[model samples]
Target: MTTYKESGVDIAAGEEAVKKIKNDVKKTFNKNVLLDIGGFGGAFNFPVNEYKKPILVSSVDGVGTKLKIAFLSNVHDTIGQCLVNHCTNDILVLGAKPLFFLDYFATDQLKTDVFQSVVKGLTKACIENDCALIGGETAEMPGFYKKDEYDISGTVVGVLDKKNLLSNRQVQKGDILIGLESTGLHTNGYSLARNVLLNKFKIDDYIEDLGCTVAESLLAIHKSYLQPLLPIINNENLHALSHVTGGGIIANTLRVIDKKNEIFIDWDSWERPPIFKLIQDIGNVPEYDMRESMNLGIGMIMIVDSNNLSFFENHLNSVNQSYKIIGNIK
Candidate 1:
């Protein structure tokens, strides 16, 4: 008898995986989540009364090829955090606070321990961002994925007061750009990074320049800018915000600025993080590709009026957040 397990899909293992993650997933819930995990769809009771005019903002993102590093290093927990944080930062640039998150995790075969670890990371980040993990889907497809490999993607739905909505229309010339430091690559450019670095090094290999193992540097959790910027998002001087992701600085930052104004970046204003440097030198990757592909160092850019430079700088310092005055609008 060719059973489901023999054919590669394990119904039993899937059930076991769900059993392991149930409690941890519940920890991310708030009063807003009206439905449980096994339901057909997640039920969120939107807090329509919170804002005079409440707007729902949502974004979906995955960790990309960075998962290859997780597979190689046998570290799975941080990948979940990276996914949630990346999505959080996406909507955050537009001045939204996450309300709930739903995840899609798919694998060839479900391993209970790995499943548990991934959910634990997810719940941890959801709690940290004051978001609820109301529901998620775990698919076990035996032939679809390679051995021991899985892919994760998440959708974050958030709320913003219509009065506080931010956009390029608010940006103007002479806006100074303040760049916030990144933890690492932060879920981008891994395709180029791996193609270049892996030829010369293994995941566990420690490099002096990176000051850590290859996996350690690459798997650094994508930082969430919500905490620091949330308190000051509506400030008059803070004209616009940009989350630097797949397209690097120019592509991402430009999206949040006025078309009439052009951004001028002082490349030398800040030091390039070491991991980026290693990738460039080792891969002989061109300067243009580096700038277009990776964050290099800065992960978020704040466009604000020059008059309030001191105010912004002092505020960041108070929070112990490092920043660089990288450029201005022309």
Candidate 2:
């Protein structure tokens, strides 16, 4: 008799993998989570009383080829955290707080330990961001993926009062552009990085400037801004926000700028992190192309009133966040 296991899809392994992560996943739940793991669908109750006009904000993203680094280094946890945080910041730019998150994990064969590690990373971020890790799908397909390789993607849902939505109309000429420092590359540019850096050094090679192995620097978790910015979301001078992602600083910031206004960024304002510097030096990547690709050290950008600079300064300091007054819109 032929069984699914014989076809390379092990049903028992999948069940065991879920069983391992069940407890870790539960820890991320709040009162709003209506259902637990192993259900067909995840349930979350919206706190309607919290907002007079609640608007749902959402984003779907994956960690991209950054997983190549994970696959190379055999470090899976950080990439999962990167996915969660990346999704969090997407809706966060619009003044929303995370409601819940769901993830998709696919692999050629079921690896229980690695799956549990990834789930732990996901639950860790969910707990930190106050988002529910309600449910997710894990696919074990044979011959579809390369041996020992897995892919993960996520969808985040968040809610904020409709009146509190950040918009371009709030952005104006003379608005100060403040940039929040990124934690390394933050899940983008790895394809270029692997092509450039991997060719020059092994994943375990330690560069003096980085003070860590190439893998360590490349695996930095994507930073989430929800906590630091939440306190000032309603500030009148808080014009708009730009979550710097795949397109780098200028392109992402331009998404929220008014047509009548243009931003001037002082590239020299903040120092680029060593990983980026190493990539540039090795690849001789052009300025425009680099900005179009990597975050270049700044992950989140804001257009706020120059008059409220002190207000921002206090909040950033209170949160122990690093920032730079990189430019202005004019």
Task: Pick the lDDT winner.
Answer: 1
Structural similarity to truth (TM-score) of each candidate: 0.98, 0.98
Per-residue lDDT for 244-313 in model 2, tens only?
8888888889889877788899999999999899999999989888899999999999789988888898
Q: Model-by-model lDDT, in order? A: 0.91, 0.90
Give residue 196's lDDT in candidate 1 (0 to 100): 94
Cα lDDT tens digits, model 1, 228-251, are 888888887899998999899999
RMSD of 1: 1.1
So what's the TM-score on candidate 2? Answer: 0.98
Displacement of the residue 303 alpha carbon in candidate 2, Å: 0.8
